[model samples]
Structure formats: C-alpha cells, structure tokens
Target: MKAHKSKTLIVYSFLLLFCSCGLFIDKDCFDSNEYKFYLPFTLSPAQDTFHINDTIRLRADFSHELFDSITLKYYKVENEPLMCYFYFFRIDTTPTPHYTNQFSIEVDTGNVIISPDPETALRYIVYEYDKSRYVFSVKFIPHQRGVFLFGFGSEPQQHVNFQKKCPGELMDIYFTTNDGVDNNFYMMAQSPDSSMNAVPQHGFNRSGSYCFRVVE
Candidate 1:
C-alpha cells in the first residue's frame, strides 16, 4: 500500500509539473491586440488633385512587418506559438473585382516583381492580390471624373485627395476607405465622401464594387 501510494503521488506530481510548465495546459499565447495591424501604406503620386486619365500607382512594403509584429508581440517566447489576428489588412483578393468603373487597376508587372505568382481568381483583375508583399506596386487609370472609394475588406488603408480640373477647388474627386456596406467601416472621414451609388461594371460584380463617387 505504501509503494502504490508513492507511485500515485509521483504520477500526480509529474502531471502537476507539466501543467505548471504549461506543457499540458495552454501553450499558445493569444494576441488580441488589433493596433499591430494598423500598418498604413503610402499611395504613389500622393496628390490633393489627381486628374482623369492619370495613372495612379499603389505600393506598400510592410506585410512582413505586419505579420512579424504580431508574432513577436503575442507568441515570441512560447514553445509552440499560435498567432491569430482579428482583422486582415492586406489587398482584398475578391473572386470578382471590387472596384469602381471610374478607374481600372492592374499590377505593374514591369516595375513590381511578384514571385511564385500573386493571387488572382477566374474573371478577376490583378487588383485582387493576396498581399502586397515587399514592394507591391499597381497602377490604375481613371476613366471617368468622380471620387473613388476603396473596396471594403481592403486594408492597410490609403488616403488620397482628388481635385478635378474644375474652376473652383470645391473637392470634386476623392478616395476613401469605406464603401458604406451595412454601415460597417474602418476609417471615418469628417464630412464623408459622397456616396457614388453602387453599379455594375462591364463584366464585374456590382455588390463587390464597394466604391462610390460624387460627380457634379
């Protein structure tokens, strides 16, 4: 009886040791911090007034940092770290294009180097990228005269101001982060960009076209 009790005590002690060391307990350090995802990207040709028929380029090189920051903040010292982020802040890779007819976008294959191929689905434009890794560069041509709202789920947001080639500087063109779908939003503006009613493009999904404009 004494020997049996000693063996049971040893087993219990071992279990307790493992549990205290977190070997048998929660080993993954959870990351609830959302601010680490707020990596702002810069828009090429940062302008207060981008004109029609202009090629606007977008580039950002903080994807690796965005992931690493969370990894470091949440689970750097853990034996087996399971890092989880709440929101995604990269290019929105919608199966269907989520852009306005005012501008057509494409990856700058010449200036930008995408290795192992970036992501693009059937009938999807190059704008639908997985992540703007390293130097993610893309160019968009403005086809019409109005403001263009960036698509929802599109993150690492970029803020741009547009001024049409009009007489008085009354803020005719603009770029925004919110598409105003279901009243969900990321960044909020002061007066709000004019809601350019959603519409279907040549051969794209209308609902995914989360961009709007104010043409006067």
Candidate 2:
C-alpha cells in the first residue's frame, strides 16, 4: 500500500507541473506595458472623386512594430448603385483591363505597399437623329443641356420642361387627326456640342429648340 500511494503522488506531481507550464504559455503577453500600442493598418485615397476616363490611385499602410505579415481584402461598389471599374495600381507591372479580385502581399519587417487602380465607371449616352436634332439620355438627368455637368440634375431644369397647370396636378395634352395610334408627339432636344450633333455641310443645326413633334 505504501508503494502504491508513492506512485500516485509522483503522477500527481508530474500532472501539476505540466498544467502550470501550459497555463504560463497560454498567458497573453501583448496586454503588458512592454509593447507599445501602434496602429496596425491604414487606408489611403480614402476620399476621392473620378470623372469619365479618369484614373484614381489608392494605397494601404501598416506598422512594423505591430505585425510581421498581413493579408488584405479589397472591395468596391459595382453596377447596382454606381458603376465603377476597379483595377490594380501596380507601379512595376502593366495595367490590365479588368479588376475583380483580391490582391495579396507579403510584408517584410516594415511597410507593405498596395496600389489601387480606379478607372472611369460610367459612360454618358449620346445618339444622332438628324442634322438639326439629336437624342441624349444619361443615368441622371442634366440640369441643362451642356457639355459637362456634375451630380444629379433637376427635371424642370432640363432643356424641355414639362408642367401640369390644369385643375389636377397631372394633365395630358393630345391631338387627333386620322387615328389615335398614328397621331402622337414626342419632345426632342439638341446636343450640348453643336458640331458633335451633326455635319454642318448637311445643313443641320440645333438652336435651343424644344416641343418638336413627330408624325408617324
């Protein structure tokens, strides 16, 4: 019995030692005062704007004292609300046509460089009708038919304004000659650039004219 008890005691002593060492290893050293607090990550080109056919640059920053290596994920707004094409901002490599993937980088002991490639996301609409007439439709309305206008435009501020002055807030105006389907009218406008509208040799001109009707 004495020998059995001694063996049990030895086993208990070994178990206790193992558990104590494991506990010490699991203890977090990062919360201690020996290590200073530093920002681990940063994002650049945080606030920027882009026009058609314009390119934007982006960057990421990090601290050497904080991390040994890092893995980053990139994302951008797509065709739902805003249309934008993202690309890689590679200084050493050639530019690509598409950007729909996450790029990974290995940081040595110091800084990791990440470059963003942003291209024009949206395209404006312009169509040709005749020498004196042109058609234009954009995602957002333009304040006035002009070469360049930014942001959302007012409906009334358009080249041809539509208003309801009748008893009801909504009114309709129509004319009939031969048949209801054959007699209809559509409003048209001219392009902001007169020369771009049509060829001058064809005697085509748009002089801020509106309320033009079409016969079918």
Candidate 3:
C-alpha cells in the first residue's frame, strides 16, 4: 500500500509540471506586444469628389516605411447595397485590369524599394455602377438611390509617427447620385503631399459638378 501511494504521488507531480510548462509556452507564443506593429500610413481618395458611375481612386503613400511586408483588408458597410472594385497599383504605372468586386477583399503589398515620387505610391480604385444603377431594378427611383461608401481596414491600426504618436485614421469615400443629397459626405481636402496625416472628415456633401452623370 505504501508503494502504490508513492507511485500515485509521483504521477500527480509529473502532471502538474506538464501543465505549468504548457501554460508558459502558450504565454510566450502569444505575447500581444510582439504583434503590436503600427500601420505604415492612412488611406485617402486621390480625388475627393465622385458621382454616379464615376471611377474613384484611393491612394496610400508608404514611401517612408521601414517594413517591406503589409496586409490590407477592405470592408463594406453592413446592409448597404454598395459595391466596389478594388485595384492595386505598385508605382505610378497603370495598375492591371485584374480587380475583385465584393463586399471585402484582401491584398498583400509585397516588399518594394520605397521612393519619394508618386510612382512609388499604391493606388486603389472603387468602381460603382459599371453599366447603370437602374439595371438592377426596373422600379428604381432617383431619390431612393444610395451612395457608395468604401474604405480600408488594417491589421494593426495605422498611426502617424509624430512627437505624440498619433494613431492612423481611415475615411470612407462617398459617391453620391447627381440629384440625391448625401448628408454623410465630407471634403477630403488633404493633398497627398500634406504633412498633417489623418483621415478626411465626414458629413459634408461633395459638389455635384465633380461627379459623372450617367445617361442610359
């Protein structure tokens, strides 16, 4: 009986040691600090104003980042009929026609030598109503039309490398109909060259003249 009790105690000790070691290993593997890298830059529209059937381009300049690898994800507003075609441009060169039209798409911006010129910039275009919005529904009414609101999502939130370390921001671009008023609109006046980095404001309607009027 003494020997059996000793064996049981030895087994319990081994089990306790195994569990403690496993807990430590998991803690080391999943340290949140290790994955706390900030996003390189913020996303904005190359041209602020957009209209029905207009091809909008969003640009992000990462020419000053040290990291070469990045993962970017795009999301759509919930319960909204809005859709966008995403395209990626490596340099000033024209991006390929390949595009993903969906509620969301992911892109891996591979490593590239950073440069100061706009050529080194990455461009994303959101195309809405390739043919006509009316084609979707014969009863489509002008006033009932919706606007296009699309933006980017980053793994680690974007941040500006300032003295105070400002967190990076994202602004959704709106493509309002010619006659319809979009109260959610805001002016994206910040030029790509501006030193102040933040997502453009929301809630100011973009002028109608900047948008394309589609005629069916």
The clash numbers for all candidates, in the given order, read: 1, 0, 4
TM-score of model number 3: 0.26
lDDT computed for candidate 1: 0.33
Provide the overall lDDT of each model, using Cα atoms, as 2-decimal numbers.
Answer: 0.33, 0.23, 0.27
Order of the predicted models by lDDT, top scorer first: 1, 3, 2
Candidates 2 and 3: which is better by TM-score? 3
For candidate 2, the lDDT comes to: 0.23
Model 2 spans > 4 angstroms off: 19-48, 67-216
Could you arrange the candidates by TM-score from highest to lowest? 1, 3, 2
Name the 10 consecutive residues with the lowest summed lDDT in model 2.
205-214
lDDT of 2 by residue, 38-71 (tens): 1111111222222332322222122122211111
Mind giving the per-residue lDDT tens digits that candidate 1 earns over 100-157?
4445667764232222322321122122223433334567676655444343122231
Clashing pairs in 3: 92-119, 158-168, 159-168, 185-204
Stretches of candidate 3 exceeding 4 Å from the true structure: 19-47, 51-55, 59-146, 153-216
Q: After superposition, how far is residue 161 of candidate 3 from its true place, in Å?
A: 27
Per residue, candidate 3 scores C-alpha lDDT tens digits across 49-91 of 3344343322222221222122232222222222222222111
User: Each prediction's Cα RMSD?
Assistant: 15.8, 27.8, 18.2
lDDT of 2 at 86: 17
